[model samples]
Target: MKEKIIETSIELFDRKGFKETSVQEIVEAMGVTKGAFYYYFKSKEELLRDICLTYIEDLLQQQERILRDENKDCTTKLYEIVYMLIHNIRTRRKSARIFFREMRHLHEEHLQEIKAKRRAFRENYQKLIEEGIAEGEFKQTHTPHMVTFGILGITNWSYYWFNPDGEISEEKLAEIYVDLILNGIKNREGK
Candidate 1:
């Protein structure tokens, strides 16, 4: 029942902005009463909070796992992390949209919590970039912080236009992104 409510809410919230989606509409979409929703989530805001937490926390865990794999180099780890982001965007398309787009609807406290988790996620990627630099795999021409944001900006923004059914597969998209990150799009031969 809880999962049903969360899933239904995600669909609705993704289709209609979180501020626009009402508890009544969510319950009706689930074919349940408000009591059913209240039994699990105190209010629609609480549901949104849960959705935000669940999405970021899950990504944090996945990021930690990739970082913990000692067998892989920083470059491989970075590639895997990019792939993970693209894969998550592909699999949890709706949830990813809501997680990134509807976060403004969360209360101040919940917003802070989500922001902290998001910061940790971004920091973890920055650390990976730092590691890559230390290992001589990545150029130190740019600051790690800037590079981290560049990587994230490229991959995260894909949620807005990435079409899973389009010409490029997620794997290919990850490769293209990783290539663009590692090797700039400049026609070096012309130089």
Candidate 2:
């Protein structure tokens, strides 16, 4: 029942902005009573908090696993991480949309918590970029922090327009992004 409410709320919240969605709408979508919702969550904001926490935390865990794999090189790890984000966007499009778009509706306390987790995710990317630089795989011209944001910005923004049913597969799109990151789009005259 709790999971039902959360899933239903995510659907509603994705379609209707969090501020626009009401408890009545959530319960109606789930065919449950308000009392049922109250039994699981104290308020609509609480449900939103749960959704944000679950989404970010799950991504963090996946990233941590990738980071822990000692066998993969920095370049390979970077590709896999980008693939993970793109694959997630492909698989969980609605949740991804809500995670990125509806977060501002959270109250200050919940917002802070989400921000901390988000920072952790960003740090993971920064550390990976730093490793790539240390190994001479990536150019040190840019700061790892800046490079991390660039990679994240490119991959994360795909949620807004990446078509799951489009002709391009997620794997191909990920490869394109990884290639773009590794090699700029400039055409070499002699090559």
Candidate 3:
């Protein structure tokens, strides 16, 4: 019952912005009573916070697996990280949208926690870029923090318009991002 409400709420929140979605609408859409909703979540804000936390937690877990694995090189792990992000966006589009779009709706206290997790996630990627630079795999011209943020922005922003059902698969899309990040946008005269 709790899972159903959260899943339905995520769909509603994505379709209708968080501010536009009401407790009544959530319960009505799920055909659950107010008592049931309150039993699972204290308030709409709490539910929103749960949604945000769940996303950040899941992302961090996946990143940890990639980062902590010594078997993969920095470049391969970087590619896998981007691939996982793209796969998450495609497989969990509603959750992805709510995560990126409605996070600002969270209150200050919850916002701080969410921001901390976000920073940790970004830092993981930053460390990857720094490792690549250290290993001489990536160009040293750019700062790791800047490259991390750029990679994040490019990948996360795809949620706004990316259609997973389109011709391109997540792996291919990841390759495109990896290529862009490693090689950059400028055209080279020779291969």
The top-ranked prediction according to TM-score is 1
**Per-model tally of clashing residue pairs:** 0, 0, 0
Model 3 residue 44 CA deviation in Å:
0.1
lDDT for 57 in candidate 3 is 94
lDDT (0 to 1) per candidate:
0.92, 0.90, 0.92
Q: For candidate 1, write residues 70-149 as lDDT tens digits.
A: 99998899889999999887678888899899999888999999999999999999999998898999998989999999
TM-score of 2: 0.96
Ten contiguous residues minimizing lDDT sum, candidate 1: 87-96
RMSD of each: 0.9, 1.2, 1.3
Candidate 2 Cα misplacement greater than 4 A, ranges = none
Better of 2 and 3 by lDDT: 3
lDDT for model 3 comes to 0.92
lDDT of 3 by residue, 1-191 (tens): 98899899999999999999999999999887999999989999999999999999999999999999999899999999999989987677888899999999999999999999999999999989889899988889998898988999999988888888899988999999999988887878866
Question: Cα miss at 74, model 3 (Å)?
Answer: 0.9
Candidate 2 has which clashing residue pairs, if any? none
